[model samples]
Target: MKEFNNKELEIVKYIKEYLPFREKHIISTRELSIEIAEKYNIDTEKTSIAALCHDLGKRYKDDEMRKIIFDNDNIEYPKHITGALLHARVSSIIAEKEFNITDKEILNAIESHTVGHANMSMLEKIIYAADYLEPTRKLETAERIREKIFIDFDKAFLEVVLESITFVLSKNQYLSDKTIELYNSLVVN
Candidate 1:
């Protein structure tokens, strides 16, 4: 059992009560992110904090997400996104405004963990990878990522992003422009 900061503890309590179904996912992400950060010589505290709160917005309904996104003028909400992806933006807002998170890197990690960006910080990479590789998530792509995670962070991240894109396409689901931008940024030379 990790001792969370006051704010982290609050977020944890909220998650436990609101998203009991995903309690394991949150903890798994936090632990895996901390491990990845330590392995890559990044800050463990920041990684842990970011991972712990990454999915905070998942507790909200679609209507609540719309309000949160509308209120956070700073966040550029996509023209359209599935209710599932909207949680990432809402989580980032709550992480800072409600949880008193002041670290830009940690906030960025939380924001970009879902759809990675052009030039992600090391902490961002760790959080994004850990979110996908968390133990609660049992995808074949996750196993492949685990095999390469300790070996190459960039490669593993790219694989996860590609896998996500492929999954979205296979389902004939709505794809965010950010995902395409991320893919171009990472893969297009």
Candidate 2:
């Protein structure tokens, strides 16, 4: 078991109690997030906290997630947002309201992990790449992106965003406008 601070321990306990099924994925994400953060000289504490809470709302049903989104006045979600994309925003809210996270970067990372936006900070990139390229993902592209991260951070971020768009297109799902903006920002200008 990795050593965690009091707050992290509380978050771990919460996840174990409420979302035991997602524990493995969350740990994988946290470990990878720490690795990436260290490589880039980013704040590991914020990275770990964001990683641990990134999927905090994953287990919520769509209806429950919608209700939560509707209830939060600060959240401005697109009307078409649904499924997994909804979790990211909800998780950010939970992190703020439940865990008292005041860091804007951490909250942004959690919210943008699922569908990235333009001009993301290093912390956001670390969380986003770690979430997708964590070992448990079992995607060949993810492994390639994981390796690319150490060599060329910006390229890896771009690749991951493109890959995410490709995956969503493959699934015929509704792609978030944030993702498209990220791709354009990286490739266009």
For residues 1-189, what per-residue lDDT tens digits would candidate 2 score against the true structure? 447999999999989988899999999999998988988899999999999999999879877888898899546556677858889988998999999998999999999999888898999989998998999979999998899898899999888888888889999989877888888889987
The 10-residue segment of model 1 with minimum total lDDT is: 74-83
Best-performing candidate as measured by TM-score: 2
Q: How high a TM-score does candidate 1 get?
A: 0.90
Question: lDDT tens digits, residues 1-189, model 1?
Answer: 457887778988888888888899999999888878878899888988899888988888877898788877645555467567888878888888887898999889898887777777889888888888887788776987876888987778888888888988999988777778878877767
User: Which residue pairs clash in candidate 2?
Assistant: none
All-Cα superposition RMSD per candidate: 2.1, 1.7
> After TM-score superposition, what is the CA distance of residue 77 in candidate 2 from its true location, in Å?
5.9
Superposition TM-score, candidate 2 onto the true structure: 0.94
- Those runs of model 2 whose alpha carbons end farther than 4 Å from true positions after fitting are 74-80
Q: How many clashes in candidate 1? A: 0
